[model samples]
Target: MSRERLNVQAPVHELIAARWSPRAFDARPVETEKLASCLEAARWAPSCYNDQPWRFLVADRHQEGEAWQRLFDCLSPGNQTWARRAPVLILACAATRFGHNGQPNRWAQYDTGQAMMSLVLQAIALGLAAHQMGGFDAGRVRQAFAIPDEYDLMSVAALGYPGDPAVLDEETRQRELASHQRKPLEEIAFAGRRGLGFMVPDSLGWKAKVGQSACPGTIRISIRTWLKPWSGLGSRAGGCSTWAPAPAPRRCPWPGGAFRWWPPMSLRPRWIGPGGWRSGKGWR
Candidate 1:
């Protein structure tokens, strides 16, 4: 018999790197406090005009009234089987109008995306997993929850621990149950134009351009680039404002001594010498 090459493996940094959308969930119920924490994390995301326009309708199987069933009814019958095991089912919604400003906000969808990311990361940190579902009928969800016309249903999320994938129905378990892959970073991030390779200054911190939107071509770089050494740690771009850190280290000489090593973990690309960062706005 031939032995399997167990030694051939993807790095853990890459293994934990991928996100899973599990249809099968353990029956273990999540605590309300934990769920609240997840939502609170979402609440802090940065939105265009600082207009946080996301709301969550959370349902748990343990609820006494008909609310649980109501929420479940919102999901397609196909989703009912697997999702029923998810202790918590959350409906993500975004307001169509931007706050009391009354005009339509171009970034509301982007902002909601930022919020959902926050919630997902928080769940991961809490040792919980969440699967964001786009399969549900949005119109049915709106009607079942009595969600108002002002809001648009974004997604349905199933949250809990992982269960045996084997238990899933043959069709679902085989079709989309496997781990998925992310597009290469090169395909995602770009320079001045779609093909241009650009670098971000270490001082400006890390910023991830969101979605499949093309690069903005010529984003205006923030003018005040005095190279504060640790300044980059403070300001991150994208809808990820919540990820920004508070008051960076005091303006000391740049760290890593003479080498000035750029951490590979920094998502932001590197630039030329001092004051070499580029910026613009149009992609998306």
Candidate 2:
């Protein structure tokens, strides 16, 4: 059984929530048909303007003599530490120019990411484990593979069956056993404006499980603490309200009787010229 499962905030497809990256991969050769199926899944990924920009350079350890070693050597030492156990290595790349117009395709990398995700998900569905690594010698990969300048080497992936945790060293094994985690939805989802968090109803059964003490003034905290005050205190105070432990005097209003309350400066919604709400910040 897989050691880790997603600690998801809300319900998700079982496949999606079950998929995870593991450093301990069994030394078993993945079937050729399975590899082809994973690639086929990537082939169908939607790209910008229907320009399929993704490409893959595969090396099977069970096949030819030096091909697998070449690919393994291209990986960074830290990645090679565990990735070497996998029976397959794939070099994911993308064409920088649009095939149709030959113009620089800024979306190439983004499209390639989607394609890689498709490949990963397919591998997961096939009862395989795939771990993508950004730590690699791009220059070495290009030189060794004779890659054209038009292609960008995006990432490397190690694919195989899940292996024994005992095969991994203590530190890696510990990480492999750790629970899967993600940022709370309150941190990512936004309301009417940026920085204002859209509170997911408690009925959804989603709550912050991770300690956020390190980031006291983050947008998530600000929004969670301020949204209620903005609506409750602002409306009752005749427009805007400041957060206070005790009742305080009402602050001055804007030009058009718009209530202005003191909240964290970062959480303040931008006031556009009459009838528009603008937020100067961008969400992640």
Query: Which is the leading candidate under TM-score?
Result: 2
Deviating ranges (above 4 Å) for candidate 1:
1-18, 175-177, 197-284
| Segments in model 2 whose C-alpha atoms lie over 4 Å from true places | 1-6, 204-284
Mind giving the per-residue lDDT tens digits that candidate 2 earns over 227-275? 2234344411112211111111132222232322222222223222213
- C-alpha lDDT of candidate 2 relative to the true structure: 0.65
Q: What are the per-residue Cα lDDT tens digits for candidate 1 across 1-284?
A: 11111111111221132234667777778887888889999999998888898988888777623666777777777888788888888888888797767898777777898999889877866767788877788887788778898887898898886666557888876644332344544566787689764443333333222121111111111222222245356443322211101111232222211111112224323331223333322211
Listed per model in order, the count of residue pairs whose N, CA or C atoms clash below 3 Å is 11, 0
**Worst 10 contiguous positions by lDDT, candidate 2:** 213-222
Candidate-wise lDDT, in order: 0.57, 0.65
TM-score of each: 0.62, 0.69
